[model samples]
Target: MATVESVKTKDKKREKYIVTTMKRLFKNKLAIVGLVIVILQIILALFAPFMTAHDPAAQNLANRELPVFSDGHWLGTDNYGRDVWSRIVFGARISLVVGITAVSLGLIGGTILGLLAGYYRKLDAIIMRFVDLLFSFPGILLAMLIIAILGTSLVNVAIAISIWSIPTCARIVRGSVLSIKEKEYIMAMRSMGASDLRIMIRHILPNASAPIIVFATMRMATAILSTAALSYLGLGAQPPTPEWGAMISQGQDFMWSAPHLTIVPGIAIMLTVFAFNVLGDGLRDALDPNMDLQE
Candidate 1:
């Protein structure tokens, strides 16, 4: 009877928390805009096939550079004469796949490392030292080095992005764990004979999750941008793939004659990064109930 009642009360608290969070998040206009933008992009990516009958790779040199919003092409054709709108719709699929997958890899791996380091003094020194070594190189440089070794491909791009991202996530999660493990609940779990792994996983991590969630959201933007940059540099998704960065790279040569190619993809990248950043900020504010929303 006591356990049943306790579970019911806990469920109620969770329900209330969800409702409050939604209310706070919706109150932020910028966040709402970001959410809408992201949702539309996701929808477009999901329905790319149905949204456009033209193949993203189908080229018609005779119709090249027809200009934006032209017949059928809508946003115009690229130097390759491929449909810009179709490529963009298709591009979103790969861009998001790479970004989300890489971030997930980093977050999962980093969170585990951080939990171990924060809970164990001996491990903390070694883990942090490795992180410090990775930090010596710039994030993009580190990603480039990894890509250089692994060679270029969609899968490799995701892996390269994860390499640098892991260190950042580790550092952030480590800090959170360091603070959370010292709290009373963690101590209580320890006193109750819970194993170190159990205590850290069940108690410390839940308390530390908010910051990790926020960091993950922001890191996603970085990952997407990095993927695009790498693609632009010819170290990411190969030619004919229509990845936004690669599209921009292809269009760079025709900048003077036809600016639409670069401008379209450029705007896509910008809006994506902007959406994630604003959404991340909104999450931070929404998660912290004490923050004054009026201002």
Candidate 2:
């Protein structure tokens, strides 16, 4: 009976381990709420053509500066009598595109540099010096400088944001690689005469991926904000494009008469950034078991 009881206890322990390992993520109330908001934003972006009744770019000076909850234009019209809600909906595409593309560029560039630097001590000094140079400038300032040189356009804005983000991603990846390269498994692989490429890709990268994943998630939010800032400054997606930043810029003149233009996009930016941040936090906690226990 004691033997049977012991066997059952071991089974329970195994079940517990499996359950914890496969626990549902983003289940926290805040995280779930954030996810819902993000999903709505994505849906709005994807279905803007079908969902919105008005052309986002169509302008009517006669009906300009209408107040919210008035006429056929719900959420009011902007300075040009363009639908504020429709513009906000369409703007999601530009924001998401910039965020995802810029972050991807940064991730690819930074990961390569970080892997190289961490794997080869001889290259570390050179890579670290360049990273230090980038770090000297604040990220937004660095992006602005790049934009100044590249000139204002959607592609230029993306490039500028990616450049600023690369150093941060590289630094995080380097730190992770530093720790991972010293692990017993890495040393074992090295001892087996694995090629450098094989060792870095097969052994080192997998172990170092957690921090990189978190950084990428956070960077997406930063990219969105940066893109918006560029647009506000007339350096990003141009007028008639329905970008959030440009929308806010156009709405500033009618701040008193039609506040929806500013308020709506402002809310959009805030909610999007907040969602990404909360999701990132949740992901960080979920991925790191130690973090869960610490809380």
Candidate 3:
């Protein structure tokens, strides 16, 4: 009965902590704006098919470069005469998915490497040396190199970005794990004969999660921006895909004739990146243990 009561108490405390964190997060004005922007983008991505009337891929030479607010084309037509609004809406889905998927993959790989390296002193040198090898190269250059070898496709782009993300995440997780593994509770768990895996997963990981969460949030912005950059360089999402980067690439030729084509997607990428970045900043502040929380 006492064990059960203690478990329930812990659960309640966990819930309270979450609520308090959220309350602090909401108190930041910039965080609120970032949250709203991120949510808006998600809504647009989720309902992309219904958000616009015209098909993003369907082209009409007759409607080529139709100016913004023209008849049926709200944001105007691209040089291919595809609806700009439809493309942008659909592009949101691509950006968000690619960002999330790549980050998730990177996080998983990094977490495992970090946990193993931090928990086992023998493995630390080998793993960190490998991480150092990856870190030696500039991130974008490394990604571009990977894409060059993997071929120019969306899947390859995601893979490349995820690979690029691994080193940074591994370093962060390793630092957190090192700090947490030395704590008194962790030492107590070891003395109690708990399995290494159980102790690491149940205790160390949870305590280290605050920094991980912040890194993931900030990394999403980098992922989105990288996706666009690769696509613009003709190393990612192919033409006619309506990807923001590819759209910008396609629109560059018609810059003088129809500047809206490039401007619109440029703004979209900028806003999405900004949203994730400020939200990440807000999360860092909210999660800081040193910060005083208001009642």
Candidate 4:
């Protein structure tokens, strides 16, 4: 009964913390806008078929390069006569899936490495040296190199981005662990003979999660942007896929005559990245104990 009551108390505290964090997040105007954009994007991605009538992959030569607000095609028709709006709507899924997947994999791998490096003194130098080697290259360059070796495709792009993300995430988690491991409670746990894995997983990781959450949010923006850039460069989502970057690449030839081809998808990428960034900033501030929240 006591254990069950303690668990209920902990659950209530967690719920209260979440509520307070959300309230703080909502207080920022930019964060609210970002949240709205992100929510809309997720909705579009999930309900894409319901959101648009046209097939993103289906082509019609007759409707090719139609201007924005065209009769049936809401946003316009691309050079291939695919409805730009439909394609953009569908593209949201590709972008978000790749971004979220890459970040998740990277975070998992990084968190493990960080825990090992920070907790076990003998492994610190070896793990950190590996992380430093990855950090030596610029992120984009590293991703491109990975793609070049792995071959061009959306999955490959995600893999590349995940690899690029790992070092940074590892560094962040390592820092947090380093700071957390020396705390009084952590020492108490050690003195109580709690297993290292239990101490790291159950205690240290939760305490280190704020920074990781902020990093993951911001990294989503980077991952999306990177996916688009890779696709634009012909190393991701091939033609007829309706990927924003591939769309941009396909449309660049009609820049003067049918600028909407490039402009529309470009705006999509921009807004999505912007949304994630501002939301991440809001989260970072909200999570910071020293930061002031609006009343």
Q: Rate the local accuracy (lDDT) of all candidates.
A: 0.89, 0.84, 0.93, 0.93
RMSD (Cα, Å) for all candidates, in order, is: 1.7, 5.2, 1.4, 1.9
Residue-level lDDT tens digits of model 3 in 19-135:
878988999999889999999999999999889999999999999999999999989999888999999999999999999989999999999999999999999999999999999
TM-score of each: 0.95, 0.90, 0.97, 0.95
For model 4, the run of ten residues with the poorest summed lDDT: 286-295
lDDT of 4: 0.93
* Runs off by more than 4 Å, candidate 2: 1-24, 292-295
Between candidates 1 and 2, name the one with more favorable lDDT.
1
**Candidate 1, residues 1-295: lDDT per residue as tens digits?**
9979988998898789778888889999999898898899899888989988799999999999879879988899988788999999999988889999999998988898888888788999999999899989999999999989999988998998887888888888899888888888688878889998788777788878878888888888999999999999999989899799999999999998899999999999999999999999999998885764554
Model 3 lDDT, residue 213, Cα: 98
Give lDDT tens digits, candidate 4, residues 1-295. Answer: 9979989999998888788788889888999899999999999999999999999999999998999989999799987789999999999999999999999999998999998998888999999999999999999899999999989999999999999999989889999999999999899999999999999999999999999999999999999999999999999999889899999999999999999999999999999999999999999988886764443
- The total of clashing pairs for model 1 equals 0
| Ordering by TM-score | 3, 1, 4, 2
> How close to the true structure is residue 220 of candidate 1, measured as C-alpha lDDT?
86
Model 1: pairs clashing at backbone N, Cα or C within 3 Å? none
